[model samples]
Target chain A: MIDSGIRLPWNRRLKLLIAYDGSSFSGWQRQKHDRTIQGEIEKCLSIMTNEDIFLHGAGRTDGGVHAEGMVAHFDCSSRIPDQNFMRGLNSMLPGAIRILDTNTCDPSFHARFSAIGKKYHYTVFTGKVHPPRIRLYSHHVTAPLNLATINSCLQAVVGTHDFSSFENSGSRDKSLTGGRGAVRTIYSARLLQQDKDCLVFEFIGDGFLKNMVRNLVGTILEAGRGKFDAEQFAAILAAKDRSSGGPTAPPQGLFLKQVFYQDRTLDHCISGKD
Target chain B: MIDSGIRLPWNRRLKLLIAYDGSSFSGWQRQKHDRTIQGEIEKCLSIMTNEDIFLHGAGRTDGGVHAEGMVAHFDCSSRIPDQNFMRGLNSMLPGAIRILDTNTCDPSFHARFSAIGKKYHYTVFTGKVHPPRIRLYSHHVTAPLNLATINSCLQAVVGTHDFSSFENSGSRDKSLTGGRGAVRTIYSARLLQQDKDCLVFEFIGDGFLKNMVRNLVGTILEAGRGKFDAEQFAAILAAKDRSSGGPTAPPQGLFLKQVFYQDRTLDHCISGKD
Candidate 1:
């Protein structure tokens, strides 16, 4: 009943690393009345390949969120050459969405399901006045912050814990299965480059709930602004409630910087197209 | 009668150094119904200041012709603070159109009439393939050519001449104000930095007729391809007819790099803005 070795329907699946400056989009997912990057890609793919090609993302990012190494997967029956796919798909996509790399997978490699650990980088430009060039890509923080204080707070949120304190209250569980609660294992959380204008916070984890990274960023930002210290941050995480969390940060600074997988079984032919 | 000293018009004329990426726009000038950079800027200004703003440009750039330092002038009766006018006008403008610098000028300082010389840069990517990152800003040429040969031919068209051969035969003759073709002076037209992938041609002259730079670029591109040798280029200039010109290159590669003003009127205010 498992059908592990049944080569009868061994279809082809493509894994892709897509980057987008999502300023003019509604989000990664398909919406009822708004334009989404996924919807655009799906529509363009269906037209170009003459098939109903649905796109699956590693995770859906909110509006205004940018990505440099965002991952996604889709199955297709067309016999298009892999070397030309990157050019073709990119030609269809607008200037904002860029297909950085692509590869053929074992048809079972779902971008979300097969992931082991994911890493996200949030960039914030901390200055009294933000420069014009980096305003689009980074969060402009006018408040004065100390790096040592923020790092101390970030260290307490790294390990395994029930992350109810960091979940977005407005976000709903969108899976077919109902009443899901998050108990994700956060491998590491460190505020990297705390001493620079372009501040980066990298979070490596097995899996993440909705808006988890952004919420964590919000918490760290509060700690940086001296609203709460490291011990207070730990106590808030121990509360196990959304009300105990800090304010959710804006999506503009959060990036799906890199997506991790159990097996990066990608071919050169597909990746070479870029 | 010129209103002098005692009575002055309430509206003041301001000069603006505008920069734009032309890929998303129709052209510099406004069309009947289509979208153009000039039209968008004027529309935004009209909306912001509650006045009908008209844009008078130094030169007319065709569709897909970008500019780094294009010049334009406008008069506004609104009580525009010197500091706020530059910022407010740009804040209302689209993201692509940036007011690089601003200056208040004499009422009679027409953007087109007061111009001394214009410097345009034509960028060509000469390699086996075009670079994806810079594809929008440059032209792609696959055939390899000798740099020394191309550089030698450029030395011939440096000085003053009747560049009818480098003007489009069928292009508009608006420069023939009184039925005489423009006999403008060409200070320099040289090709610099000719290596593996990039060739930049810098043209500085008193003025340029319609499609003159494109025609010049086409002529040089042909010479670089070994079709038009040095002697043929000299003959083309001597012919004093547009039919003698070579192919007209695409408009994407050309950028209005800078418009040089003889006086130091702009540098003072530009320094303050910076």
Candidate 2:
């Protein structure tokens, strides 16, 4: 067994509250040659602890999808203080990825398995000109969007549903899904903010399948564009077929805003929203 | 004269309201070979109009400084409607630089010579961790700043003063001084916003010397950090020597927020600030 020169246990589970700008990475998963958020963090942790450390993320985000509170866990015997890991990792990793917080947790706690829900934000710029500063964080559509139609469409996605119509086929492994398959519960779905030229959509769900949020956004956008009404959007959802959904929205506009473990209430997930 | 088939003036002055992410560009000014906001736009304008186009910026922002409403002007014989220039140039130009608005102005109206004043924003992140999403746009400082002291210090800079202490040497042409060397008017200087972990400083002035805003921000930040008091800040201004000023703040936090022409009222310069 590895020694930390102390009486404490050799391996302790540490959970990291993370954030990353997804523009520079291939994605969140580790690949052999590609740069990924997980791969970079794992390599940094391994170097810091002098052990091969594998990080378990709450979920995988596709390339160009940003995150503000992505959770991950890894075990190490380095004996370093929890705060030092945050500081060290932030200094070692590229500016695109940051360790927001770190803490030692019970061995039973798992970043992925223990996560009860996740919150995401998809921002769209409906203005004629997309400002350069926010171009990376928002999708631009010059066409005027119907906010009433978008809100009505969003209401249909709140309950538990088999979201196969919004899931991209072959993007997930069958075994890892743990028999849940396409069924997921969306606790809250609404537009958080609607400014003069921008819309911020917030979704808190039990879990998401691969590209589920983007697909939902794309389909909802079609309804907002008058391609369909609320009834048609619900019909598409009821179809439960992958081919029934609209195109997948681009990744840049999506952000994994937060992940919830024990607290799944709307008030807890959102700031000051009842 | 260039033929447009339908006859209009061969040399109509066109004004452009522009924005850019300055991290990827060398600076606003065009160099022989270096990538610049002006160079890229000029090249595209030349290609579109089939004539060598020269762009005149209201002012030059240093490398890594962003702009949301920078103004410029150029003369061309192209009969393309004003709207088409905005659309066509945006398509040809990189996403980092955008033309927000384009309009034909009188031949006597020069972007640089006719400019009245400019407004700039300096954003600082005081949180322990700078979010990756805003890392390119803000400066991070972990130390708590004295907002009261900062505001008091800002009050000293709200009138006409010789700001040579904040001007960098060799950055401006001596002949361009126009007989009022090192002196400029500051109509407004104050802290625009103070959120949980961020402070935004706004400066509106008749004109600014090279590196004036950044140097002033650095010196004011020094006062905010208790390096000096308001009286001492005024004394630094009175010194009129560049050596008396504090360090020059980084360029990333600076933004050319807007440029004023003909209108100089505070109500017009800021949105709902009056």
Candidate 3:
């Protein structure tokens, strides 16, 4: 029965922990004319397993947005060991993308649907001169920033709120939102000062809308630069309109840090944070 | 006197502190067709000053080798402020390359001729899984490395000695060596363990030959992997032949950390160490 290569009862579902530089990729989703994370991985998988593979990512990140910890899943009938998958994929995929860990999961597990939360990190360099080494990974801002005001804005982002003001146009899906209309729960939001010149904003939420993190960062930066205060930030949140917010931040500084599942404990390890 | 634009007594020599990613550049030297650090800066300088510009670097770094405190100098007749040159060059140059600081210097000072010593760093990753974010900046090796053995090799490297075993062929310049041949003084050599898996080798010396740092690092790594011991490493040095040494390490892991001058104080600050 196994030699026939038909759909067998021993088919397994595999989960992958991923990280990518994102500078060389068009985006996370596969496209006909562009190099993307999904397309590259799927092609390698098909070659290895000799079966057409479809990869489902937790979420799609925009072009040039990096990821330190991402989650994805695929089904394969090949009897290859779990560790070989990581080695095989890394050898074939570009150095910019890597499969950090792989394991077999329950058949019912879904990369997108079963996710309980996600974590993101957006880095901003407030130095006088942006260092060349981190140019591809950070956003540079020379202007003075008031951290107190930015913290206040971050405080307002906690709890359940309608984040329509931060969401961009044309990516909302009624099925994905479950008719919540741009409403989501924010578990935690805070700022980490890695150094005098590096500001890292960490956000862990139930889910995020398209371009939501970048929009929040842009608007919060305006608050930090003394364009407005916590009151205005609250007002913008209450407005629930995209036009009420500031411009979207550039993509290079953003990173999809991790995805949280219901069964896994939150790991504070700072892997791939560079 | 300033209006004529001829070579006047007021023509000042300007020193520039530069940092570049180096992954995009061919090398530090100017080439007719290839993009290089010197070529890019000279082009921008010529346009800014409306005169042909020649940049003299403290030393030439090979392609794919990064730098943080690389120094260079050029003679300019334009009376642009030192700060403006920094800003103007940074604005025109690619983000991978940056002019960190600029200032006027004595007319007699030469970038390469006046260097008293130099510092270099080589990074190696011995982790089971090399992280994707630093793949371009660090060399990855999975074999277990013995730090004690490597440190012994490093200790053996200090003091004046002939380094022919660690120098590659075809870059010897008799005028620059001053008839010293491969003889050079290593002021200090040490290994810094940044983390459990990252090993950084720091070398300070009066001068280094072509491929010397990379060659030393490659030989030291072989020692760390138990391919040889300290006595054998000493024998390799005593052999005074390139064929007796280990292979040259790749360029991506190497960084020209700083160039010392006779009068300048040694700043222990870890600027551009990343």
Judged by TM-score, which candidate is best? 2
Q: Which stretches of model 3 miss by more than 4 angstroms?
A: A1-9, A263-274, B1-9, B267-274
Regions more than 4 Å wrong, model 2? A1-8, A264-267, A270-274, B1-7, B264-267, B270-274
Candidate 2, lDDT over the whole model: 0.90
- Relative to the real complex, the DockQ score for model 3 comes to 0.78
TM-score of each: 0.67, 0.95, 0.94
lDDT of each residue in A140-215, candidate 2, tens digit only: 9887788899999999999899999999988788887889889999988999776888899889888999999999
Better of 1 and 2 by DockQ: 2
Candidate 2 lDDT by residue in tens digits, B163-203: 99999998877787798999999988988776788899999
RMSD of each: 7.8, 2.7, 3.5
Quantify how close model 3 is to the true structure by its C-alpha RMSD in Å. Answer: 3.5
Of 1 and 2, the candidate ahead on lDDT is: 2
Worst 10 residues of 1 chain A by lDDT: A265-274
Better of 1 and 3 by TM-score: 3
Task: Supply the TM-score for candidate 3.
Answer: 0.94
Superior by DockQ: candidate 1 or candidate 3: 3
> Comparing chain B with the reference, what is the TM-score for each candidate?
0.87, 0.94, 0.93
